[model samples]
Target: MAPGLLDRSRTVAPPGWSRWLIPPAALSVHLSIGQAYAWSVFKPALESSLNLSGTASALPFQLGMVMLGLSAAFGGTLVERNGPRWAMTVSLLCFCSGFLLASLGAAVEQYWLVVFGYGFVGGIGLGIGYISPVSTLIKWFPDRPGMATGIAIMGFGGGALIASPWSAQMLESFGSDSGGVATAFLVHGLVYAVFMSLGVLLVRVPAEGWQPPGGKRPQEQQSRKPLVTTANVSARSAVRTPQFWLLWVVLCMNVTAGIGILEKAAPMIGDFFADTSTPVSAAAAAGFVALLSLANMGGRFLWSSTSDVIGRKNMYRCYLGVGGLMYLGIVLLGDSSKPLFIVCAMVIISFYGGGFATVPAYLKDLFGTYEVGAIHGRLLTAWSTAGVLGPLIVNWIADSQEAAGRSGAGLYGLALSIMIGLLAVGFVANELIRPVNPKHHLPEPASAAGQAEGTAGHEGGAEHKEATGR
Candidate 1:
């Protein structure tokens, strides 16, 4: 909204710019907005201060997730047109303002205001910010799209790692009451606003003729096989393709499986051994949660980078195929052996995190980078779907079986079985992902020029390199 904010001339990267800087620019936004995951740190405090039930306290977070998916799906094309600077700035404003509004809501004890502020407003920020870096990163690192995106998305996973402890410490230093929570929200808004501006200022789109050092055009590189089509698919056309929906199912199932474990990490371990000889302790359960966080964060970088070597399709095969077997191992072996449980859960979570990190590159592979950001944005609805589905599948089965007098592992048996089934479905979908039909490809000249432009820019060509310290 600032004057000359979306100026096209400012976005184009100068010749000889270091591509490595792009990751940090992307990370700046990802890390700040990724604080959404740390909402759980506020959950208990909200419940206690507001005298709400567990489910009631979770509404803001759940709504935020729902809004995140919806906003991303709707705003994807806009992000492509507006460029990353516009998207990141918008994200910064909305994200920070959500916290401030939520702070006011918490201070006044108006639960609905908190929901409107954090859930509705903040969700928009998450969606825009999440896709802001993808297209740019892919363009900047055409040779390593997977690694570039992994670096940014990994920050999203790691953001929770930073925020969880930071928030806990803040609450401890202040007080655990409503006032303290309000203060925490206020501080988070202020701090993150400052932090995310780094991305807005630093991110750049490549100049029209720019290319990575020694990189060849798709035609020149014909001898090498690419994982997906070099042909461009418009975002609209991309959605019409079966590849889009199949990948949707793939992402949805993968996320659902991960969220199943993530949502119940602290309690599930304890319950698994409650009536068993092992008798898991509270500290052990806490450690399990920490382990999952580490795995989730680490996997984002590790597995996604690996995709570059193995190809995106094969990488997902490992995620869904190998991941399903891990779930099966947990179902049969987790209750009986704590070591096995931890190992399986850790690996499962790695695949889960891997799934998130890899999807952008996968989209690029399938659809091309022209609208990869927008396509990726539309695909995040699957995450929103999984957010609801994962927890539902786990909780519903656990509760139903518990009421039926099942105990320990028996309570989770049906749920784990269902998870395996979902993975099987995802595996089939991944296999179904053939190359996009030639019908969907953009004709040659326009497609070549579009890709050559590297990234979209605003109409006015005013300089913005000053914003990035050029």
Candidate 2:
């Protein structure tokens, strides 16, 4: 941790360096921080050991998510100003330190300390880590921004696949008591520290003037794709455009629709089959949750990469449009066929994960890579909104229905219908997006050195021009 080691200048890729090395570096940070998705694995054990209510045990994860949005939104520009290496190092320190602090809290049986440490401190790490490599990846692979982002982001979705079972085994071996929880937290902090350090060391910005082999210039790409822009928009200007808010709505609605089912997946499926001839066992419900996770992880890479070919807007049409059909299928056919139900649910979740992975590329297309990371960070406020909004809609509706003497699939019927409506709104929002106005474009820098400095550590030194409306 020398003072200059994490500086942006230190991270410039040497001439002839392969840009392909970047993805794995990005993945290292993403996979470690993606453990946030597996926080549920500790919830039950924490409740048992600390004598807490379910809501209370959930505080850490919930607060962590809130902090994730806030930190990403606020810390984004600083990330752009510094570099991915600096951001990754900061994320590693905060995330690992939070775990270590939480471990101490668990050992002392001070639940409040655990909440503050994991929720507040670790949440900062999640936000910063999530955005750290995004711009860099976009820079290194401008020709394939969608696929480049997809690879790193897919690791975030997949992190729980590794963490959940591994954490469970540790809990089983050490016991789920407070002491065991402490030990597990200690191990997690240490292990993630080592893993995330790789990202800090390996990440590099493309040297100034570098471009991918045989890649089309931004203007050439823009000729075919109307939404693609050669002009850059500062993060500040991006937020002022109608396109930004339109995308915000698109992301929020898509996430809300998908998360509604995801948060309630286990219980919803079980409830669907409760009055049927074949009841869902607890084990089967658990397996169903696992299936959703896999779909979520796989979809990130698959759908986002597909966006590179089909375009970001069309990719979202599939997510929000076909996704709505999936919800309708669930609502119309409820409990009649288990296989169909599983298939529909899996499709919805896949779209959910795809939406997350595809958005950075979407931002790059509309905003350009100059400050796309910061723009992406600002857009994540939609996710935080959806996180709260989705669960509440499903849980509240289900509770009301059950109290009204509902049974079987009837409990979630209203909720599924609501998700369809939200997806339709998102679909409309997606269709409305167009090229950003020229008025919002960042003005060209006056001098060559100044211009080069602006684009140097970013995507490339492609000369920028004032955008003319498409």
Candidate 3:
């Protein structure tokens, strides 16, 4: 697509445009970036071909995650100012080029190049691509923001499910050697570059005065529930609010607890059952991982959509409250029964995925849709923090406990106990949340401000313009 053709004003949806198409645009971006989760499929190949240690081979993924969060945090305002089309275009270039660069790095036996390509370049793609469609989706589906985000974010969870086996098959057929890995990387870059362009082309911002079919104006809706404040908070202002930090803690703790288990899932299963009557084989462990992926994908859609009906805060209460209990179950009954262990792990992962999908809408609820993409981008710092912290806590504890003669569920007890405490703290933070103070809301426009001061009759109509982004 031509760069000039994608001007933000030119990309606004027509009056009758269907919002259903928006989710697919979002999926095209998310599904591609979500391949970050499938980096493990390349780990053994990188290690074997380059003769690198496990820690050395992991640098690309770790650095990529850190860059994902940092780039998103820094680039968020640019994305909002330039609009989704611009963001999607930049994401496509960086993401695809990273893969191509990584392919070259592999072919030349330069591991640092691979790290730079995928970690730094591709990680920027992951961050920008992840947030590109969020504000657009929220604007299009004002009445069902949670469900809209669920559809898009669910693609991120499912991306690994699609990529892992597909990449494995490609590696198997081409060969697991460095040359073969390069070929796989080259193919991935080319294919994803083409795939992600669909988002760049299809995405649209809502035109002025656009609303869902027969939907009421923002003022009318807010009048029905005074709690749903109709006010904008800039990203700068948002970060200063107590609500933002509370949410940061909520997301960080929830993600930390879930990711710890997910990071060590396949091996954790093996160890937990190693001395039991039913030992989990490598194949069974793979199946367990697949089940967790399914639960993750399902929860992104199911639990997030449910949040639309039940309210974002209430749904998170279920996530932390019930999720904490599920972890307790795993810690207590994990060694006794395989079925119980599997069930508890599945539910916990579901909540983990659900938390990611629902948070954007939660931001919409608390901060308003103005600059939500940027706010959401800033909030992802929590994920990066948890990404490092969660794995460190779990892996370090498990390793130290094993060295000290602990085995099975005992290795995880300390981690799970810590997770429960984090959840309790998050629950309290959620309870502390209240509506944003009026002083923090965006100043009313001069005309709107004048009308409100001059006449009570004009106040509703004036406020409606500001609230609806008209």
Candidate 4:
């Protein structure tokens, strides 16, 4: 009945309680980044059509990941200052451009173009897009940061589910040859641009006094430092802390352990059964990839939520310590049974996914949520480091083994052993984590004051319940 009510509703979130929309906005961006996981689908096509080696063809995906971490770390402060809309908008433009540019590279048979487009440009998008909604969501859903993050992150893990099948079909329809790969990349770029735009436009931050329903804390309540409070610990101060470097080591080790399998999933499976009675088929190997994706997605939610209960430090203990045991089982067993190998690999990969999902929450808990987005952006440097390290370790070990005429589980024994060692290192790093110091606290601003009361109250209740409750 109101003349402008319909148009007004569409323009912005209704004044009181529209922060609920932030999660969907986050999903839109994450779904697109999720496509990053599907890069393997293109690898075979690149190898076959361009006559490229697995390592050469992997450059774009690898570089893209590097860029993702680098850009996120380098540009975190900008995202914080500019707000999610601006950050997300850049992500849309760069990500789309990366795809479009890669399409051109594929069409012309210029590999570096794909490298520059997808790796550099699109990687930047991935980084910015990844962190854009993080602080915003944590702010909006202070009580259930884990769940809110899981809602969007689950889409990221699932993004590849949609992308892998869709891309494979596109490759099939487009003929899997060079031109088809070009078409696929082009379409993917354009389509994701459209998909991510919905997030940029629809996302809204909480107003000055807004709080999560039933989750508000009162002012004047003492609160522990948030791990993600960037204002207090600038990138300079953050890196200076023992905790930051320790986390870096922990994340890098965890990521490297997982990626050792991810980079060589197909060949690894194939190698495992190269001498078996019923060896892995091409289809079976592809199935393994899909299974890994499922584990990755499941782990993101499961492990992160587990951290909410078990505490971040202890949860990582399982990731690195028990994770080492899993790898040991895989190494000792030697793919003796496909089922055991698959189960072990899946569990390890899930922990990898969980590590990723939990890190943001870890940052939120340690640094405070004020500038969590920026702090997380900076911490992504660990991701960049692991991206390169993980693949390099796997591929290098595999390559070395191949050169030395090793195959199957024999080639990976060395790699898995290395992962076990690295995870042990991460365990030490996890142990080194401690509460952030008071020197990192930023003075509260007047604008933040309105929300501070409830924020502190909720935190106080949690601390009391956590520290002293029966």
Assess every candidate by TM-score: 0.93, 0.94, 0.92, 0.84
The candidate, 3 or 4, that scores higher on lDDT is 3
State each model's CA lDDT, in order: 0.85, 0.88, 0.85, 0.78
What lDDT tens digits, residue by residue, belong to model 4 across residues 355-380? 88888777776666655677787777
In candidate 3, which residue ranges exceed 4 Å CA deviation? 1-3, 216-227, 446-470
- lDDT for each residue of candidate 3 in 1-470, tens digit (9 for 90 to 100): 65486566567676777888899999999999999999989999999999989998888888888888987899987787677888999999999999999999999999999999998999999999999898888888888888899999999998887888889999998898999999999999999999999999988876665666775454216345433666767687899999999999999988998898899999988888999889999999999999999999999999999987778889999999999999999889888889999999999999999999999999988887767888999999999888878889999989899899998878889988988988888888878888888777766552233222212212343355458574
Error of 1 at 410 (Å): 1.5
Off by over 4 Å in 1: 1-3, 214-223, 275-277, 455-470
At residue 259, give the lDDT of candidate 3. 92
Better of 2 and 4 by lDDT: 2
Of candidate 3, the 10-residue stretch with the lowest lDDT total is 450-459
Candidate 1 residue-wise lDDT at 284: 89
Residue 457, model 3: Cα distance from true site in angstroms: 25
Q: Rank the candidates by TM-score, best first.
A: 2, 1, 3, 4
Q: After superposing candidate 2, which stretches have Cα over 4 Å from the reference? A: 1-3, 214-223, 446-470
lDDT, candidate 1, at 293: 92
Writing each residue's lDDT as its tens digit, candidate 1 over 1-470 gives 65495664567777877778889999999998888898988989999998989988888887888878887898987787778888999899988999999999999999888888999899899889899989999888777778889999999998888998999999887787889989999999999999998898888888876766765443214445555677878787899999999999999999999999998888889988898877889998999999999999899999999987788889999999999999999888888888899999999999999999999999988888767888998999899889889999999999999999998788888998899999999999999998889898766654665575444422211122223232
